[model samples]
Target: MKRTVLAIDIGSTKICALIAEIDDDNNAQIIGAGIAKAQGLRKGSITNIELASKSIKSALNDAKRVAGTELRSAIVTISGAYTKSLNSSGIVNIPNKEITLNEIQRVMHTSLYNANIPNEFEVLHALPYNFKVDDQDFIEDPLGMNAARLEVETHIITTQKSNLNNLRKAVKAAGVEVESVVLSGYASAIAVLNADEKELGAAVVDMGGNTSNIVIHSGHAIRYNDFLGVGSNHITNDLSMALHTPLHTADNVKITYGSLYAPSNDLIELPVIGDETSSHEVSLEVVHNVIYARVEETLMIIAQSIEKSGLKEHMGAGVVLTGGFTKIEGLRELAVAILDNMPVRLAKPTDVGGLFDTLRDPSYSGAVGLIKYLADGYTAYEIDVNRRMRHAGEESATHTGSLPEEAPKFEPIAPASSTPTSAAPTPPVKDEKIAESATMVNIGSNKPVQDDQPNPISKFWNWATQLF
Candidate 1:
């Protein structure tokens, strides 16, 4: 069967919407795409819901117009700014002594339930990285294997409830329902990392206009992730300040002349901030210095984060860099220098076909990765609270298969708390249809934050006019 998939990636500098067609083999062909200048956002958080919604709508409309179709659902990208991650393990006894998909799902759900998630945060992904069947460990997939007990080690990613709600509201206001939320860093990894990189361990850093997302993938899953507030836009700001040029001019200069390599004595002219008609000359050396300073600092921070993850030693494939900022000259050389001499490879989206020329850029990694994510069913075994309950009722009436006579009943251990935990109840008998598309896990509260502020765009233009 073939179906269409939509993905939206909201960034501080731009918002991108992509629509694609997925075939029987899970290959995605880009059918439509839209990009709009981002407003009402700072460092990946929504500052003004109205303006953010408008931006999202603009991108969505553009994509729909191109595809000649209307889309109402999308798998959106969320930033790592408010995300936190932890590792947890869950074990379940195999009653039939045969591991099936149901057992795999149960163990993953148990791992999520066992995690001590913060009350203010909600789970986004519970990715199983390792599995152990009885005494044998490092099992990738134990389905159909005979084992008395199964244990799984998972990496759980969560985000703040308030921020997630704000994101959902912005998308909803754009007339789209969020199918699933994937972390920006994780999405980038899925788009760029090769099988060798994933198996041998590697780190990916997606440097955007105003934020850089970092993810470390090893043993077939993400082991660590982090966020950096600094990005290529900071270089532009530094240039504007140091050269006394307009922000736009500084951005252009950064794109034209920015480099980390040894500087030349060439001279370049820049437009003055206030006096648009008057221009001034600046040394190329000076521009390179300013850009180098910011790039160095950003790379240093990324290297530090990798070190902090404690998984650096496992990174046999080293670091892979992508995103808009990675296009800068000499970044990979500098990354190797600053990132402890680990190998660094620059990457863009791969395995994408059909109208993908624009989508091939590193800048679109997050957006393209979202399409790949939905097509691949990265979290197929994840448990959803509402879906589980609904399936439970359905299974009780239709499930007629018998378990082994000697098999023991399986139950998830509750958390140690005075208040009852809200984790999903024990897994019900297998429901064949539900198992095919079980990818969502909605765990957060339903309270919506009020948007009572004035028009953010008007205020921004007002400030701009005053400044100019």
Candidate 2:
């Protein structure tokens, strides 16, 4: 009758952990939420295992303290450039003269069977969207409907196997089972979009620190999904370079003065950081110009991706945005200017209660959305990266200068006893010497890679870390 689910949205800039309690009668409610600064990570990938683990543990502990309990399993949110999407259809015969839940599950799996992905890739979600029952089409649920044939269309979300494995490993190290990994963009869409918007077709472009995801919703299902490797972080970096300022300073300035829309034609001088008296004055026009250019490029790329999916023309409900970057002033105006005056609305997680004021921020959309996703009865398709290319640390274990095998144990041979039976066994080797040799082997086997050296494992991990 009651269930608890922990949802975490791991990002390049910060990590958001949410604890929720759900009941059939009450729907869902957020009981605890925690935020922590992310470290040892770049573009959503864990670069330093120790740092990442600590960051996650810190956030987890804060939420646990608020909830008054420890979470054993979590439904986490994952997003990166490595996240991929494709549409697949499956057909199954209805021999029982009626469709059932079993058939629905079968068809979804069938769609997965039709997916063509390399070993490095793993399917994360196989979500059924449109269903057809014989002559009845556009059916979302065909159960209990008499039909001879049942066919369903599914949207498949996948990511690099190794990338997922590393994230799961980090989370598991904090004593939580990685229950389900959902695409953050999809979760945002689920939480933000209403039935009318979904029916008419809409798009959710979740702009985060390192990845901005585009998920097109039409006919109440995911129509198109993709991610831009660059996001608001790129905008910050551009500001830092163009204005000749430190990254942290630029980040703060952008948050304070950044706007995608144009303002009055005037210049305002502001005190520059790292200086006691000197002030820097820049044209508001110039500021908006920089912000506009980067955001426009991002929007254009999203437009092109949607066009490729053939969903660009069908966005009748227009675009809804959810993420930290959406807080920028005049972003909606700028989006309309570049998107042909299309409607745009900023949204946060909706249709849930508890700790309402805190979780209402657009930044918490993905983390909160995950709770709704898991509570609504969904399946998580795990990626199988067990056979993936060996990680650098594991590979180094075998190549770290050959370790001597432990010498076989031996017993002292009986004296020949004047029978000349076994060539008078040689003097037994010293027990202490053998024991010392075994210890050396054991130490070598556990040797860790030097921290100063480059890690090939993280190199591969970083390549696909641009997730949702």
| Per-model root-mean-square deviation over C-alphas | 17.7, 20.0
Candidate 2 lDDT over residue span 218-331, tens digit each: 877777888778688888888766665667867876887787655667776655556737767777676677777888888787767767778877889999988888888877
Candidate 2, overall lDDT? 0.69
* Candidate that would win on lDDT: 1
Pairs that clash in candidate 1: none
Cα-lDDT of candidate 1: 0.79
**Would you estimate the TM-scores of all the predictions?**
0.83, 0.76
Candidate 1 stretches with Cα past 4 Å from truth are: 377-468
Q: Pick by TM-score: which candidate is best?
A: 1
Across 134-181, the per-residue lDDT of candidate 1 in tens digits comes to: 999989768789987789888888999999899999999999988778
lDDT of all the models against the reference?
0.79, 0.69
